[model samples]
Target chain A: MPELLPFAVSLKGTENAVRDGLAQAMACLAPLHLNTDDAGTVELVLAEALNNVVEHALASTPELTAIEIRGSHGADGLHITVIDCGAPMPDGTAPLAKTPNLDVETHDMPEGGFGWYLIHTLATDVKYSRVGAANHLSLQLPVGV
Target chain B: MELTSSTEHGLQIVTVQEPRIDAAVALAFKDRMRDTTEGGIDTVVLDLNHVQFIDSSGLGAIVAAMKNLAPDRKLILAGLTPTVDKVFRLTRMDSVFGVFPTVEAALTKLRA
Candidate 1:
């Protein structure tokens, strides 16, 4: 059977939109025939990446913001690019993925800040750039290789 | 987010009925958790057997639920699927929470 070519999904910058977009994106990758573990990895990475755009990049102007997710499968893996017409990443760069301090007391445990960490840990070749009025973040998942 | 709770062996076992716990329902999940766990039970066991996927927001909501019951009550996790377990392990939150392979195991160990 012939593989599905590159796919794209456009969504609004909202939580529900991200969820629906992810579902559509996963459906598009159905042709990849990824194993269970690999499929989970792809889902996780994409969720984190898209969530960041909705939460950070589009936080200020969510109503007017839009996100685009594009993906293609290759011998290396599944490469995904998330683009948004929102604010550029702080200082025009992606935040460093630092493991939060988990040794603290239970009351002081972090309730957030794990998004980038998960993305960086699970996805490779993560790159961020500001093209004109849009922010482009791309990464590769080591699946379907 | 939909959750159901029942008392078994004096433990409040709360089960998440949804499949994906991502940013979309993280807040709702946290609120539901708080409402479901508001009682005399000091230990609550979260059964995630039906949940197949969880994002960082969901992970953070779980952590928040634990913190909301900290110092007096406790939150235990059970029946983590592969993706859910991966999130917990990658964030090192697994070490923070007492995880069991099944709700029965958690109940057995706690009841013992």
Candidate 2:
């Protein structure tokens, strides 16, 4: 299926690059005519995906250092694909979503591990694959559906 | 992220002036929040009315800030935009933190 108004950007796989990728992705999403709520959804989901690349994939393979984000809006909804020539997913599978221990004691609350949880919960049609030495992740978010 | 703080009803309210809080500023945000919130009232309310977006890192930063307060102080979040609020709810952090729609509401609750 052909994508509507496709946009893509490539940068180093680092935290700063995730920031830049988010900005560029926002620019790409500008013309998609998304409502404010949908835009915010895409932004949050995209940030989580990109930041995962920076923190896990990129951290593992500093030598394999290119992160590419490609996205488009179409009849289905907003679709995003993040490609990184960095580390593959552990066990070659997307991490299972674990509900954080929300009912913990005051002193035992968790400070992290919410990234994949939000990504899985917010985005639809989420997928991850390892192609050779590259990691490919794709996510879709509906526009006012 | 630019943050401002004030005291209301014996609770410290800190407002985040930035629209987005993500990996880019999570560390800086935590450090600055620690500094701004250090040595104030035992209870603090984070005002995020201006923050329209937050990622896992930003959420973790807020949690980290809260944990940094430790056994002595408390951290609450207020004025979360719908998007930010959704993230919190989806991640179940809403159950972990006391979230209010407005700073005044949080202050009122804390006072009572």
Candidate 3:
């Protein structure tokens, strides 16, 4: 199959923005006709990645925060790069994708800290970088190959 | 964040009427769950058949809901779609809850 043109979606750094951006990104992938599982994987990974930007990277920025998502499908898989004009990751690195401990007591169970884990588990080649004034996250979802 | 509840056979069934339970509504969903399941039956079944998508935040809210009813009441999960099931299985949270294929199946097994 021929290569599809890369699609980019610009969004604000907000929860509702993430939701709307995800819907548009998924719609852009419709041409690939990805299976249900693949579609879901793409959507979930994007949601987590974008949420990280809105909640963490852009947390302190009260000014207008801009987030851009670019995606392209190829033989290897779907390549996604999320760019944001926000604070660089702490220590200039992304947090390790460690799965939260589920062995704790019921009341002590973790209610958060699963975003990066899900992104790492479902997506491959996860990379994070600080480019000047922006944070760039790129990953590959093994779908539509 | 529309949740409908009904009680049957001494079990409270709470159904999520929305298509998603992501960050956009995670907190609201959690708060609504606390209100809906407050002082209900000992066992609560959350129906997720209509929900096609769930992110980590949404998963966290569900976990919070279950924890909110801890040591007294219990929260069970039913009608998980494939995508939602994938999240639970990947996170290994499926082991933490009594997951059923459908609400009917959950009610049958829980009633027995």
Candidate 4:
């Protein structure tokens, strides 16, 4: 632990609160000289993560779930960790995003496969861990930038 | 997030004046865009100046909206913060939608 700042927030993952919490985190982290976008990026990623927890992670069980985000700075890079107290992913799901359709092909049904895609695209590094029914996601960024 | 749209020289500029559009609000975003397009607007310029974060669901919703308007109308994205830009680039969405430095720039190009 290289002097990390931890933030813990509990909410219904109602989208708006997740958005605000992400903004608040960015405001606190980006000022450290990590060039982060003040736009829909955070909202998109956090929304997906929070939603997964709210819908599938806890399966609407209302287990008094909470998300813990941690940020730290060091000579290596900027570290962001999101921890959710919920169920593990279905069998073998990981943090990596699915393959994107790059051929500009038309779709019969225009839905699915965009959220994690955007998250994987924006985050320099992402890692997911399931520890005894907990989803621990960490996103990192280069500090030199 | 509430989406407000107005025309600028025949261009439909949709502005989302809320903080975030994560998964919970992603469907609302798509619904609003659908309503905006169904209202007879063709060209769209999505303004994300007020947004700070966009999770996977949020990004998916944006792409979904663009697809919904495809082969008929076009969608242009504007006012992407550094994080937002990174997301697009990483997901290769930089190629999916026309991105602009500002809304005015996107409109200018569309008019040209």
Top candidate (lDDT) = 3
Q: Of 1 and 2, which scores higher on DockQ?
A: 1
Cand. 3 TM to true fold: 0.98
**Residues B8-35, candidate 3, lDDT per residue (tens digit)?**
8889999999999999899999999999
- Cα lDDT tens digits, model 3, A30-138, are 8888889999999999999999998888888724888999998888899999999888888887788898899999998888999989998999889999888888999
RMSD values for the candidates in order, in angstroms, are: 1.3, 2.4, 1.1, 3.8
Native A-B interface contacts kept, per candidate: 0.80, 0.80, 0.82, 0.55
Q: Every model's DockQ, to 2 decimals?
A: 0.87, 0.74, 0.89, 0.47
Rank list by DockQ:
3, 1, 2, 4
Instruction: Give the runs in model 2 whose Cα sits over 4 Å from its true position.
Output: A1-3, A60-64
lDDT by residue (tens digit), candidate 2, B20-74: 8888899999999989988775688899999988888888899889888867788
lDDT by residue (tens digit), candidate 1, B26-88: 999999999998865569999999999999999999999999988788999999999899999
Among residues 3 or more apart in sequence or in different chains, the pairs in candidate 2 whose N, CA or C atoms overlap within 3 Å are none
**Superior candidate under lDDT, 2 versus 3:** 3
Give me the runs in candidate 4 sitting further than 4 Å from their true place. Answer: A1-14, A27-33, A37-48, A92-95, A108-111, A115-127, A138-140
Model 2, position B82, has a per-residue lDDT of 84
lDDT sort, best first: 3, 1, 2, 4
What TM-score does candidate 4 reach?
Answer: 0.76
Model 2: per-residue Cα lDDT over A1-145, one tens digit each? 3335778988787777777778887877666666777877888888888888888888876545888898777777878899988778888888867778768776677878888787887787888999888888999887733
